[model samples]
Target: MSQVLSVNVGAGADKPYAKVRLTGIDKRPADGPVAVRAPGPKRGVSGVAGDFIGDERHHGGDRQAVYAFQREDLDRWQGELGRDLPNGCFGENLTTVGIDLEQVLVGERWTVGDPADGEALELEVTDPRIPCRTFSGFLAERGWVKRFTADARPGTYLSVVRPGQVRAGDEVRRTFVPDHDVTIGLLFRATTTQRELLPRLLVARDYLDAETRSLVERRETFTLDDA
Candidate 1:
């Protein structure tokens, strides 16, 4: 069954490896339910209660409110890196198992936990996370950014649709899938390695996060101006 292995949250702290000196990437598993909601118009606010985002200009907001990574992917990285990576090691708010996050379509909706209890969190897949210097530094891996981008399983960012609380062991049910072929993996490729694929993202334009939408719009404008 698809379930949350852990619900993680970070308190802002000093990080020598982080370019910004302070970071919230070292998330730890929460002991109990954590509130989830739409992080208003703020740039760096996190949707998960008590969660912190380090970079205001590049991270968080409504679209990238919550980040999730698959346990299978973490295991794969652990194997490759020859180290033990616990849940939330990648700075994910939710460490999930049994879901193929790479194939989850952009705009796919997931209901987490039981709604009858009135605290099920609803999240929509928004975009694939782009690896940054902080991520690279966190791992202390050589050429980490390039390696992660090349691997193309950058995990998925989610936007909170229905405010509620989530806890570890909660079941995750796919409630909706957009009628577009823009999977997280595909979108990641389009944004990073394959510029030619940018045009293909138009089909899921409405589902894209703000940053990705802007990028697609710029690409469209460039194409038109060039023509």
Candidate 2:
């Protein structure tokens, strides 16, 4: 029962780095062709390249930019950035439309692309991206960090299954499936406030990042051997 909300493309669509923005309901029970290729393992790829199951971005400290925006903040997101930066700040390639992106938990699956392909590809939610100072500073917003983490609206990270041109207005159909049946809120709480509830957060380990894992590991170690 997914629906298309709004379709927004860049004003400079013909430009070399035109941004594509889509805002609307992600179609349900939709599938499109996905052509995934290995971007590389953390850093750079030297050998064979083809569709890959997973790819890491920071492993080799290689920075690959993409679109990013929380679901609820879309109303004035563009304006906000424009006002803040005056010359455009955030580099989010696409701005989601109708979906309350914050609600999408980790491990959720999405099928993106034209319907003619018949469920052509799948993308999985892997981790939460904690924005760094550069991003925050770019917007010149002081409380942006607190607001982002507090909202826990960590936009979903995609494990691209099919690669193709994703333009504005393209429907993004989402399927909720938690590997450990836990929510992102629970994990965020377990790590920050409810340290005692760390075990519960383990349910969604597959969605955790290295920093989160390390925190959990440290907590576990402390619990196992108290000196």
Q: Pick the candidate with the highest TM-score.
A: 1
**C-alpha lDDT of all candidate models, in order:** 0.91, 0.45
| Residue range with the least summed lDDT across 10 consecutive positions in model 2 | 45-54
Across 1-227, the per-residue lDDT of candidate 1 in tens digits comes to 99999999998999878867679999999998999999986878999999988799888988889999999999999999999999999999999999999999999999999957565789999888999999988889999999999999988999998999899999999999889898999999998999878888999999876667899989998988999
lDDT of 2: 0.45
Instruction: Write the residue-wise lDDT of candidate 2 on 65-115 in tens digits.
Output: 222344346445546555532111333333465655556665676665566
Segments in model 2 whose C-alpha atoms lie over 4 Å from true places: 1-38, 43-68, 76-89, 118-121, 185-197, 224-227
Which residue window of length 10 is worst by lDDT in model 1?
113-122
- Please tell me which predicted candidate would have the highest lDDT against the true structure: 1
Note the clash tally of each candidate: 0, 15
